[model samples]
Target: MRIATGDDPFVVEILPETPSTNAVLAQRARQGAPEGLVVVTEHQTAGRGRLDRTWETPLHSALTFSVLLRPPAEQVPAERWPWLPLLAGLAVTTALREEGYAAGVKWPNDVLVAGADGDRKVCGILVERIEAATGSTSGPGPAAVVGIGINTSLTAEELPVPTATSLAIESGGLVDRTAVLRHVLRVLFEHYADWVADSESLRPAYVRASATLGREVRAELPGGGTLVGTATAVDATGRLVVTTPQGDRVVGAGDVVHLRPAR
Candidate 1:
């Protein structure tokens, strides 16, 4: 596909191959790259996920990119961090549906596409914060990078798991990667702007699109703790409100897997 120029406000940097788009963008941000600069690679040799897991993408067959944003210092609290992933997921889901693919947000950041037998993960998002220098008490960091990976043309054989799929596979035809990328960026920018304006209004849409709500789940916590619960909802701050066996708990960070409860 021909790369379009001057059509979007953001600066798009396309690379043939990168170790990791997220890592590259973070390095650039540390060196003072401006917000809205997007780094995209046709292939990622060492892509990374939230917990340092591997994210593999074949050359020129998927959307692999990272967007840089530096929100104001006052708004850099933990409560607002989840908005980055939420907005990114919303953008991708909207873009897929616009292209006539059935898609939804599997809680946290995975994009689930409806398959013939069941739902499969088609996209993933990872958001990371760039911290300030040591011992510097000057508020939050300078930048945050949100990385996104979407399976566009990969066949079932290329999928990492039987529960994973691609937009092309789901549609039974090739999809326009450029079109999907454009739509996702546009949607994300719009929602990010709205989030800056008023976060309250964006909560309902996220809740509606979230796949974890009302489902039983097993969350593997950061410190090797496990919580079995039913996802009640996501609070305004974007934390998962889970009703655990002990009681209700707000999970700030964890790997969540939806579970099928016993009959």
Candidate 2:
């Protein structure tokens, strides 16, 4: 499928340069922009990864973009909002696998490919929630700004970190940014729409494409604790289920570091 350039459900806006696609779309959402607004930039002066870390890629070397989502409360329960990023990760994993790349989802929203050292990250996702106004009986809404950044054409030296690899680097110097963008959007939107209707089909695909499963992991929890165990599965709500010594536990948010490769 070509980029959703025509009159389609998705309204894709391309920019030659921007500080961050998420920033642009967040402003639009506050201004009452409709759902399905996608902002893709060729360059980002202030791109960010999870936990507010900086993510920089050379101009035209990556697919950097954000999509706006306003999930209806009546259709998607509030508790399921955390699954948005996980679903997006699954979509990207599927798209890359179709392109003949051995991609896998690393919990929450990281897409990774195995490397000589470990699982090198190729994609990072940040999902920001925008809360609705208070004291309005006619209100119960929040928009999600889903930012996806993928390393496409970066050379080996240009990688942001030793644990980061680009598609060009991993695939022996062949990559297509436009096709990647189109495939990503098509898969993401299709799965997202279907998920909003049922919210049940995501886990099976995610589990199948996961790199964290069946591996020893140490999750750095957000509350200043760490959970170490084998990542056995992902529950229906997309939380990682770990078989820790304290018994089976579910981690809703964390930075998971795989201590061993998937068996």
Candidate 3:
């Protein structure tokens, strides 16, 4: 896919390969790099997914990149900063649907297609807050590095696990990586800018594209345990509301596995 000849959407820096684009940008942000800077590498050897898990992809077969965003503190509350990853997830999910893959997010921001076994992940989002050195959450509101990885051409054999998938695997062949990346970035940036401007609910669109909601799920809660229930809804604050036998619980962080209801 060809990037058009015109004003670039963001300042993009491309490398043949790298250990991790997020790592590169994190160091840059510490040195006072301005926002709108992006780093993309053809291959990532030490890429990290949520929960510190390693993310690996074939060289040149995916869009492995990170973009920096310094949302104006006055506009976006620090507590609401969690929406960045969700925003990125929604962007990728919409992009895939446009490409004819039935894509949706599995809470927070794991992009996947529903399958007989479970949701087969095609992308993962990791949003890191750029915190103050004094270990305080104050000051410049919130800075974030949004890392997105999309598998464009990985075959079934190349998938890291049976639960993982790719556009090639799902679409039956290679997709235009450049085209996919362009569309996703466009979608993410636009939605982000709109949110920063209006501070409204992105939850509606997010809820619509979420495969997690309305399903019986088993969530691996952060502190060490599990919560079993049906994902009833995603609240305005982006929390997953699960209706368990105990009560309605709002999950802020966890690994959710969509489960098939017992027959």
Q: Pick the candidate with the highest TM-score.
A: 2
Could you estimate the TM-score for every candidate?
0.88, 0.90, 0.89
C-alpha lDDT of candidate 2 relative to the true structure? 0.84
Give each model's whole-structure lDDT.
Answer: 0.79, 0.84, 0.79
* Poorly placed runs, candidate 1 (over 4 Å): 1-7, 74-78, 132-141, 222-224, 255-263
TM-score of 1: 0.88
Pairs in clash, predicted candidate 3: none
Best by lDDT: 2
User: Model 2 — which ten-residue stretch has the worst lDDT?
Assistant: 254-263
Candidate 3, overall lDDT? 0.79
> What is candidate 3's lDDT per residue for 1-263, written digit by digit as tens?
11332565577788788888899888777666767778889889999977688867778878898988998877787877767788889989988898888899878788998666767888988888875455645444346989999888888788888888888877776588878877887788888888788655577889899887788877765566777889899776677888999999887754443333322
lDDT of 1 by residue, 1-263 (tens): 22545766577889888899999989888777778889988899898887688867788878899998887757456567777787788878877787887888877768998766877889988899886656756543667799999998998788888888888888888688877888888888887778877777678888877776888877766566677779898787677888976889886654443332221
- What is the C-alpha lDDT profile of model 2 across 90-129, one tens digit per residue? 9999999999888998887889987767788999999999
Clashing pairs in 1: none
Error of 3 at 66 (Å): 0.4
RMSD of each candidate? Answer: 3.1, 3.0, 3.4
Query: Which stretches of model 2 miss by more than 4 angstroms?
Result: 1-4, 133-140, 222-224, 254-263
